[model samples]
Target: MLTKMGKKGSSCIIFSIMLISSFFSISISSEQMIDDYRGFSDSNNSFANFTSAGSSTVAISGEPAHVGDEMIASILVSNVGSNNGVANLIIENLEDGISHSGSPVEISPGSSREVKAPITSQEQGSVSYRWWISSNGSHVNASLSGEFSVEVLPRQTISTYLESYDWSPSEGLVLDASLFLSSGASRPLLLDIFISKDDGPLNHLQEYTIEMDPGRRNLQIFLGNPSADSVFVELSPIEWSPNPTSLNYSTLTVNSPSADPSLLDIECTVSSLEPTSGESVRMKVNLTNNDNFQSPSGKLRIVLSSDQSILAESVIPPINPGVSVSYEMVIQSWPDSEIVQLEIIWSSEESSSSVFLSVQSSVRDDGFALPFDISSALLGALSGIVIVLTGRLVWRATSSRTPSTSESGIRKTRIEREEHSANVQTREIDCPFCEQRLSIPAEHDGNARCPSCSMQFNVAKMGETTSSIDEKPEAIENEIPMSFSTDDILECPGCDQTLRVPIEKRPVQSRCPVCKLEFLAEKG
Candidate 1:
């Protein structure tokens, strides 16, 4: 009976151990399954918030595409809620069969990008369209849909015809032409105009590519010279709409140049002083013909340009001889320029020439401080007289305090003191151009010349003072003296390198040897 009890106890212990292990395994598996389910549930809830952040718009570029012509139907998307999602676009509801010429595009959150869908018209007619743009990510999914329409118009017809053609030795070859277009919108048209002399084989003279809008366009083209007695001109179209014509041709006789040798004599003049930089100013110019006899017709080409590039140009009508014509042109200067110039180019069939005019900065004009103003000059003179009187009084007081010397000695002493006082009264001034220091006579007039840079400037209008060169004069009303010094120096504003330049070179344009930058310098 004891042996049987031992066997039963061992069997019960083994069964109890297995039951405990099965309980632990079931608890761990249940916990892991619950965690996975919660994760999937969280992902589904996050996707519910995913959506487009802004309005979507669809449009067609290069519209009115002709039959069999390919164009783009583009969709603009913006502001997604997630980062890096793939967008699949579906375009439907079109009779011409618009295809999705693009694949699903991957985009970033809160950014805009264009998705192009190329489309072509199978036949000419109006068609409606629908677009469904959808995107999906690992954690979210969303979509947007819209519709639009496109119009397919038929191709337009164009025809070429010559209105009039003529040639002259002086005026070149002139052709008056027109093009006819039937229906449709405006487009670019290329024309090849051919010219022949005395009914020989046609030779290409010029090719004009112009935008041919609906209606009759009258064109005037001029070629410099056609060395022919009898000339024939023909108009042919190239790579253009519709078809070209074969019967657009004209004939004309050649004319000779004017016999008067002086008929082309011309003169041009500007009407205003140099303008301020960045100042939009009107420059009026007068062109006069000096020819006394023949009234010749001529073409005028006027151009207003800068040192860098041409700013503006225009073609003016013919000017008759012995008549003066006035033309007003508007131009602007560089905003940062202290000084700018306009290079005006005038050309005609007779001759061509160019001229330049300088424009100064307004800052330069506003900073000028004139030492020779009438009031300032009067003040300086008054100060000099008072100093002379004061010096005499002081001398008298000193002489009375001490024992009196001989009469000749006293007279000599007084004269020496007066001379010393006058010398002390002289003021030092800076050149206006190179900022070179100079010493002027005590009784200086309004005009002075720089010894370092020979820049002659009127003290009445060109005097300027800066903090770096302010001088204190004992008896002079002006802080700056009115003279120039031969030993003055100039400092390059660009590189700060001091240069010893000649006095006569003052108020000149200088190129710094170190930096190679040009600057305007003045004698101080």
Candidate 2:
């Protein structure tokens, strides 16, 4: 019993010591959890305590805060904490039509820094914005926020003009301009001047920087000598007061001196100023040289000015000093009235002379009028009648003198009969030696010589075939000569007149002189 009681007591003591150690460990764990929560609360308190030196102030500098004016907003930030901090500015709630620009910065404790942001607005009114400055330290984070407002003014009105301009051979071109401002400006303005010669490209002449009070102001500019027939000047604004509405530009133009007059004189005359339509117009032109020393040669042109058509042109002959020349031209008049120009041009001397003529409208007369001269027409009719009568008389005299029997006519008939008889007795043949065609009497049958080849060959008789020839000779048939006495007579079939023909010229054609009728006088 003593041994058992001692073992039980030792076990109970060991178990009691284990329970106390467990209680101590649980107490230490609860204390550590409380300390951790306190440390977190202290960190949050540090952030809440961060503050600006005296509520960061904002100021606008440079030009006045007007619409289209670029003004700077200087934000003064002071760090009053005990440690250094990094500060970043954020724009939070900016109104419409307003803009700003800036970046982050680092600040030290007890030192103030100015952060500048450029602000501009395209509208006029109360413009407002909210800004926040976030600062970060080694052990804490801090932030400061505020709101700012400014009144933006409206834009100004302006006008400009080019008053006058002058030019000289030695001084070049000088321009005068005027400017009018409706109200005062807070900044300087820039103006540019440009000039163009003879419708050419614009050239920069001068520039002006203006700083003036409200109202009109005058300015003068000088441009060096430029060779041109005409000068054009313009005034353009480069930069002016903020958003000012004004004219774009003003301009002025000036012309150079006139050229000298020509030394040629022209005189022209027209036949009829108001002629009928479709009628021809006659013009006489006379040109004279007015210069006593120069002899000029060129071209003379007549131009229809309404349509610029060249009606007539001629080369002008050289004219001596103080000499004159004349020309005549005829042209069809236009269907309507118009002005025409006559020009004389000399290319060598570069001189010209011109004169204008006005052609009046066509005139019509509603009456009976003769198109030709009355006396000349009567004389022409009389002359035609006399010529016709003379021709008739000559023809009657010639017909009455024709002879009843003409010896020459009989002789001509006899000769024609002989030629016909000769032709009838001949026949064409080809030479065997040279194949040349020849005409010979049909009765001749012997050796014949070829005229072209000078060679002799036998001729074949009529109606006979030759050994050397491939074709038979042509035959003459029904040909017989007639014989008659010297007292033979024949009656003409046309007029019944008796004609005596010679006996040797038998079967001849004989003509009767009474009716000019011909008939054959044969032996039968």
Candidate 3:
């Protein structure tokens, strides 16, 4: 009975201890739960007054950007609530190898701020991208997004070279070239062609604006004569758009042959060495080419050396090797008796040669001399006729004279002689051959001789009535009248001498007495 009572007491004490421990644990758990609730309530109360009012914006700023160039993007954030804001800009979905980013920016209340970022692309094409703006502030937490594109232009390339070149005396210099271009945009490009001689300064030869489609094109340029032995040609670009990656300049060197003197032979001869005044002098100029293979052409100039005046100018045709050509030139002789100096000049593209010659002129005379025998015979004949006529007149006078006893008888004999001389009336007639006037007795009609030309012709009796000295004469008795039609008179063409012909013959072949030229005479 005592052992059972002890065990029961121990059991009762253990129960009491367990109940006390349980009560303390319950109190500690309650305190921990209260602390957690208080912390949750405090966090909820802190954010209870936050409000989102304004918004954020994003955009792409730079468009139509070229390849390898930087593009700009912008982000704008506005804060209209009762708190400040912070904005961040980021570019997304850009082309490969292209990127852009910006740092966060802070904005005050009731204000806005912008953020910008630069993006670079390596290739040419349309670059599509997305822009994002993240705004964080005491009253707002929002994100803005948009899509945009940037057009990237392609780079340009240009190259040029000379294909051929030529030079000539007539055409100067000619150049042929090829131009190549590769571009993705249309723009004006300046092309400059330059030339240099013997390492001299570059001279601008030609300038052209390239505005055609991208391809290969041919160009023909005429640079004229530079007058240089060695020339250098260069082609380069002056102005261009979308700056080219490869703009190669081309150059060429040209060499020319050495200059040579003229190789020509000339010979000249004149028609008369001593020409008279009012005479035409003919000169024959013969040119011979001495060159073995060269064919040359130029001008021939004739100048009077005394006054340095040009007489005649003619073009010299192209003469082949070992060829010859002749030219004839006529000039009037000077009026004075002087020496005429002439200069013949032969000029070519490279050289010139001249020859000097002279001519003499003199005055002309009008008188001519006959042979000695003919002059002597004429003088002797004239003297014999004069002596015979004088002797006859003296004999007749002596035989017919009566012995005069007084001075009155002598006077009567002289008056009878004068009356006998007055009965022989004379008339004037023209010689047909020499047109010289001759006096003959009015009653005489027979063959007569012209004293001037020694030409003999027949004279017919004139039917005219004699008038006494007291009566007034209707016509002069000393002059002979000759009336003929124009058809009866003809002029010799060779010597231009006048001849009287019969009217009965319409056309007659006759010989001129002066020049002895036989020709047909006709009436007009």
The TM-scores of all predictions, comma-separated, are 0.37, 0.41, 0.29
- Higher-lDDT candidate among 1 and 3? 3
Error of 3 at 76 (Å): 10
Position 58, candidate 1: lDDT: 61
TM-score for predicted model 3 compared with the true structure = 0.29
| Model 1 regions lying over 4 Å from their true place | 1-26, 37-53, 61-65, 68-72, 86-93, 96-98, 102-106, 134-143, 195-204, 227-524
| Colliding pairs, model 2 | 404-513
Off by over 4 Å in 3: 1-156, 165-174, 220-247, 252-524
- TM-score computed on alpha carbons, candidate 2: 0.41
Give the higher-TM-score candidate: 1 or 3: 1
lDDT tens readout by residue for model 2, 355-398: 77666656454488789996698558666855675686677555
Pairs with steric clashes in candidate 3: none
